[model samples]
Target: MVKRSRRFVAFFLAALALVLALAFVAADRWSRITARDNAELAAQSVARANQGLLVSELQKFRLLPLVLAEFPDVAEVLADANPEATAHLNAQLELLAGRTDAAVIYLIGRDGVTRAASNWRLRTSFVGQNYGFRPYFRGAMRDGASELFALGTVSGRPGLYLARRIDQNGRALGTIVVKVEFDRLEKAWGVDGGIGLVTDPHGVVLVTSRPAWRFKTTEPLSRRALEDAVRTLQFGPSPPARAPLSLSGSEASVGAGRRQEPYVAGTLPAPIDDGRLTALVPLQPFLEDARRVALLWGLAILLVAGAIVAVLLRQWDRQRMLLQSRAALSLEVERQTAELRDTNARLLVESQEREEATNKYVAAREDLARANRLGTLGQITAGVAHEINQPVAAIRTFAENSTKLITRSRPEDAQLNLGRIIALTERIASITSELRSFTRRKTPVPVQATLGSIVDGALLLLGAKASSQIEIAVSRADREHVLVGDRVRLEQVLINLLRNALDAVGKRPGAIQLTASAQGDRMTIRIVDRGPGIDPAIRERLFTPFETAKSGGLGLGLAIARDIAREFDGDLWLDPMEGPGAAFIVSLRIAR
Candidate 1:
């Protein structure tokens, strides 16, 4: 018996050892793969952020050349080469360059000779520089616009050149150029741990976080390409050297000998065509941290499992010894009874928890419905206040005037003023009544509501809060169009749509058109505005709750309006148009 017990112990120990060895290998492999993936994700995020900065910078500078190209001074300098016009433009360009944080803004004649520059006052001014050989100048002359990233011949600094052609009477005048440098951007990238690089189509590094990596070739260049690049001086006097980095899929190895380091690389295409932005993150740290954590967890689990097994084995031995005793049978009965009690207790607790969860869910749903109505009312609160304010002010004015007239024994005029006050008070009451009816969360009672009355009610709520510059024209035939819908709810839908149209055309020279047309048994009310159209970014989610373009909007008005329309078996939608501005169409059942 002793020999058998010893053999069993040895077998269990060997099994535990083998299991631990297998777990270690599996954990290590999994952790390494997970670590690399995490590194790649991080690298990708960095790459996108850096690329956004590059694109933003490029876009900002590109606008400068276009603006300058339209300047009369630029055309004057290009057409007549007037020294006074050139000097005046030079000062103007210098001031503009400073305000816009651009490196330089210059005008190139049709011959590709620089006539005026923002840096004309500087020692290395490009005022007399002949850039006829530069691709930006030639391309602008040929295609009317161009952009290139290259080393500036005079300053030897690298920047992007955006050029736009200046034309007068269909004659090519010259090209206006804006140079934007990324020194500050590069420095900001370098402050972070990872390396950032921007490469052109030919894999030539145009900008890099590491200055040494700039003007370097990410890949080998052909003999003809090298000669062309050198002759054009695109990268400056010295030929671009090969960077000490190699890429293989998502992995990268940088440096040489003992200093070599591995990285997880991620890349994104730049906004400019054929350009790419890359980020390289060190892989060693991630790998080490992940593996160490995984190993520790594995060891902790192995220790816990071993302790459990030992406890079980000791219990077995104790039971074996106890089985020889007289009280062993009683003890086993007690253990089974205790287990049964515990199971019954757990079942009772679970049943109670389920009941509580169901009750909470029902309450949450009720709260959400109430909140939705309140949110809709909140969006129109400002407009309602504006609608009531004018009448309140007029009532106050008429009340004061009546008191003065009564004291002067002018009873007739006093009575007239009092009547005016009464009329104003009635108007205020009407506004409040309309608002209160709109907010009531009751089922709609469909009734025949004239289209003209609905349009007038919505306009009353809008008031004169917006500028009088906007013309709201309603077609005369709308009065003949009647709809089968809840009058108050339909008015609310019109109010929402009209309010949006007014806001869209605010301070702009545009008119709001309220047109109604009949198709079979349905009537479609169209609210069209000549304002800037709906933004494409939010077009897909226009009717979604909490999706809004207005800064101070709650984004619930349209959603609530749409819901109200659908309650009467009608629908509201944005109509497509070939012209500028937006059109909202509300279709309802026409009165039979």
Candidate 2:
């Protein structure tokens, strides 16, 4: 047994350990997944914000070229090659560039020669430079308007160029260009710790918070693609390099060599250009938090398992002790059994006598309960007789009137009188039917009965006694509650309580209120009267047999009512209140 117990404990511990390990693994995986999703959402929000900022900046510079193209000086400069007009337009361009926050504004003739520039005073300027091969200038000349992001050949800085064709008499004269740089935007974007990149339609990093990432391909470029990029000079004379980041779906490995770190990456389209905005959020903090969460879960599971194991071990020890005591108990029981053999025979005889006495006691109790119910019926028999007499007299009068009407040759009136007689007869029958059902004696069989029906039946029985001063209100919901009790017996309980309340408030100005409500799995019926409260002397023994405050009263009504209540697993008692008047409450279980 000792070895078996040891083995059982060992197996339990092993199982518990395996469960703990599995819990840890599952918890870690779930936490990591949740963390990843949250990080992705944060990255997506950042990318959208960046895209909005980029689009707003580009839009501010977009109108500069269109407005400049409409200038008459611009058409004259391109058509006449006028140096004076060019010089004056250069200063105007300078002022417009400053007001619009544009990087530079320059004009290019149809031949692609720069006629004027906003930065003409600066050494690295576009004045007199030919841009015939530039995509923006060529596109503007062909389509009347165009936009391109490229590295400046003069300043070696990357910017977006918005261009529109200058027209003279509907003839294209030159192309007006506006440049927008993002140095300040990148600086602001980098203040918050995360990587940000703006990728062109071909997946080239046109702008980024990280300078080294600019003009780099987001993914590896093919040989032909690299050659095309270098030939077009979209980025620079040198071929665009691949970004250091390696992306796979939403995950990214940023940086290079030993410095590389994992990130949750998100990409979204930019509103202004055929471009994509990318934001990368670091995973270290989220991963650490996930680990902490997983660790907490593991600890919680371990504590619960340990507690269970301890309980099992304790029970095992108790079982072992019980086994040791069981043998001694067996021997003692055998000795006692032999000693009590004759005593048992005597006990059997005594038990039979006791059982007989108990049976008699139960019979007596039931007989007293039946007698009480009959006595209650007798008390109401006078009212019942009065009610029956009124209906009987009405029926006789209606019959006499019908006979007279028929004798007078008024057959329709006679038929109406006969119908009234039938209604009176029904009223008589209903009164008698209720009395018979109430006085009938049978074994109590509890069943699911609606409270509404019980209340209705009880009220019907007490209709003779219930006055307008006695207000009875049962809520629809409360009436719907089902009680587990004999319908007849339960009705008796309500009748007794309500009758007592009516007696208490007899000829009184105050009202007697009876209400029923359901609470949890129990139903409660309260009968409250505003008459003089119960005599304090009998308060304690209110439910005792033969206890009464009225003269010539049996006082068995409350006692029997309480007994019936208990028979069906219910209870009845007088509830104590501060002011005049008495309250009785009956509580019973609600059937599931």
Return the top candidate by lDDT. 2
Task: Find the 10 residues in a row with the least total lDDT in model 1.
Answer: 465-474
Model 1, residue 313: displacement in angstroms?
5.8
Tens-digit per-residue lDDT, 369-446, candidate 1: 345545545655776687678778988888899899999999999899888888888988987776676655555476
For model 2, the local distance difference test gives 0.84
Which residue segments of model 2 deviate by more than 4 Å?
Answer: 1-7, 222-224, 257-259, 271-273, 316-592
Residue 480, model 1, lDDT? 67
Tens digits of per-residue lDDT for model 2, 1-592: 6678778889999987788778877887888897898889888888888878887887777777777777888888889988899899999999988988889999998899899999999998899899999989999999989988898988888998888988888888889999889998888677778888888777788878999889888777778878877887878999888889888878988889999998998898864358888888888778888888788877787788889888877876888899899999999999999889979999999999999999899888877866776877876676677778888888888889988999999999999988888888888887778778787777777765799988887766666545445676889988888898888888888878777877777766337887888888888889898888899899898888888998888888898898888887889888889988888899998888
112 Cα displacement, candidate 1 (Å): 2.6
Per-model TM against the reference = 0.54, 0.52
Models, CA RMSD each: 28.5, 10.8
